[model samples]
Target: MATPPITFVPSPSYEAALRRAAELWGIQLEFWDIFGHHHVASPETLSSVLRSLGVSSESAQSLNAAIESRLWSEWSSPVAQTLVVSLSAGAIPIQLKDSEAGAEIRFEWESGGHTAVSVESADSIHPDTARLRDHQLIRIQVPLPKEATLGYHRVTVSTAGGRRAEGRLILCPDQAWQPDFLRRGGRGAGVAISLYGLRSHRNWGCGDFTDLEHFTQWASETTGVAFVALNPLHAIPNRQPYNTSPYLPNCSFYRNGIYLDVERLDEFTQSEWANRLLRSAKVQNCLAELRAAPNVEYAKVWRLKLVFLKLAFREWLRRNPQGTGRREVFLRYIEGEGNLLHRFAVYQALDEAVHKRDRNLWIWPDWPTTLHDPDSPQVREFESTHATLILFFKYVQWRIDGQVSAAQDFAQGLGMPIGLYHDLALATDRCGSDLWAHPQAYVQGCRVGSPPDDFSPKGQDWAFPPPNSIWHRDSGYELFVQSIRKNS
Candidate 1:
């Protein structure tokens, strides 16, 4: 048999504009497979990608128009949308049409102080010039001062003609935070395990922080590891097979309440109701069944733990009252967490309320359209009406944070250098609190996925919306940073 002759297809007239537009929009035009085969993006794929990014690529004129609009918007601006200044990278970039006139740069630090870019300091900074459609686009680098602290600040660029533009200026460290041992050139290893899979005779069917502390000590003693890495402790729906994966968590900023050691909490020890419930034969039977089961019973464990946590929360409220120092600590935590924790708690409260009213309502999208948005008036009313219920969820998170901290402290005290190494999941559940609370953070039309590899002949569709890079940068990447800081 003879192989068929290879057929060549003519490129579209808009192909050049499409590629240029894609490049400006940060879309990959081609890729190399693991088998050493080069794969160039087809025009259809490129158009679809451009559409997803809110750009039009239907024809040559549309492509050229989109490209021109983007370029004009960027080049005409006095400064870029965002800037990062690391310890090693000192100068900040700015753009203006008049280079001879120069521009003034001012920074408004998060600490309520202001700093102006000095003309003498940036004397050595070079200026690069380019020609736009009709005007000259000049790019200049202004030296950042050594006194700038590591945080998010606001930068304003002003021309002599009174035109100005503002952007976020993020001052970051040269590298991420590292342990002292790693900084000193020491190498170490640890046992990575799924916290939910950890079994202990004392646990209530699922692994808790108490179980973690004990396991950490044992692992360190037996394996002589510097750290014990655990799976992401992110909160999940805790339902059956569909909603239990830690990697696709209900909320990236919070931990699963099931891992909380209810018995270890002070409120649990103090609550007569909680103790009585635990002592009951009905509760004991459920605990025993869960513990003896071959797999983690996510639903049952979550239900049981939630009940105990509610009781404990009530007991805490009764014992500590509002003015006490202990109560103040929790209040401070809520305040420190700001709107992020509040929105999460509101979503949880709403989820429980809606599901209880209609047993079929599983996700936020299925809830009443009015309640879909966290900022909607109906949702705000629900939050106001169910303030105490929302506080219960917050209290659960507060207790979880304390217990997890204690476990980490125990591990560190046991001579482990890195102590607890918590993992952060890249994907957030589409139907989870994060989506319900902050839908703007993600793009709606596309799901994040990976190309085919040796592991699987078919490509993988992760089934979660890709983050909106535009939104993240506009918000100064607060949500992204919080995902890390809260998990850490």
Candidate 2:
């Protein structure tokens, strides 16, 4: 066998340096493209990748700086942004930068507690040098108690002269959650179906939480289905249509309001105004049109639903202007969701405001630059002016969340083991709330896709930009972490 010639630009040594740079910066150098060809990124490819990662690799000097920075950056600091240790893993490892004569670390548990034993210096803690690298570091091993709960904790390292550093301590289970259904029991069968495709006469044009509840009830009682897996219920913008594909959404953290059955809404059921609105000839006619359509007209469906939805919101607000039971609960949800919910609501309102002003405009970037930032003064002003509108979106979110929770509860009540399983889309669209809300974290220039493959030689280009893996990790997966919690 003969060795195939590998392409290395400039020279092999520069290529080696590029490889080292990629390794330091956490860029993936070797990958199997979709075409099944084993590809090692060339020097030029590495340079381009570095650019995408916001590192200057333009010339030799800059490249050397980036590589050096990448290599020694971690050792420069005694404290990292976060440290993770499995509970099953015996002692916690703490690293010190200087290995100074007098150094100590402390643990502050988020549960209103501190470490049982505190050592005055690293020498007393576990006095051992774990490794000798560019910088001298002492790995003080601290044994954890069996009762240590799983959560985010705080770890601080201090040296002589009051020089101190702090980092997050995340304690997790060594193993993933294994439900009883998957463990030793005899195997059972269940079904996975697209939420929209589940048919029932009660649903308004598309399947909904109500329909899902009914299906789960039937499947559990008669069919003996163990669990039900659903497609992504993430929100899609109305510019879209019903966005036929649940797999692609504008935002992933929030559930799509279109999935909420309007007729089942408390306001719709209770308010005379909402009832009258629903009874109007135009509303009836629009419903008929949507119900009869062979293929869904998503935007039309969403628009029609929004009209009734707004009416429901207005009626509910009219009923509860002050801090009432419902209002407080909704506000608490907004608060619990905190800035994430508020930002998404702002984006929604801003997006709709832009669309109303000019239907031709595409996304947040296409709008006035001032409105581009979720935290901008202009956006705050927009939120203040559109307070009711933002709250209305929040109400929609609450309803969707409640309905999903109810559906899951209903499944459990019916004795289903695993209950409802929700989906998370691969990535949010570049123009959507996720990207617009956190512009700094996402990679801008390139979209996500697989390279050329035998199945489709040209390959599949999913136009949405995925979170930059390097940036996401560097930031401790800031934006990506919440989506996991929300989706799961």
lDDT of all predictions, in order shown? 0.85, 0.74
Estimated TM-score for each candidate: 0.92, 0.89
For model 1, the superposed segments whose C-alpha errors exceed 4 Å read: 1-13, 110-112, 120-126
User: lDDT at 81 for candidate 2?
Assistant: 65
RMSD of each: 6.3, 5.2
Q: Which pairs, if any, clash in model 1?
A: none
Q: In model 2, what is the error at residue 138, expressed in angstroms?
A: 4.1
Model 2 regions more than 4 Å off: 1-14, 32-36, 97-99, 116-135, 138-140, 145-147, 184-186, 241-244, 470-478
Tens-digit per-residue lDDT, 211-284, candidate 1: 99989989989988998999999999998866899999999999999998889888899999999999999999
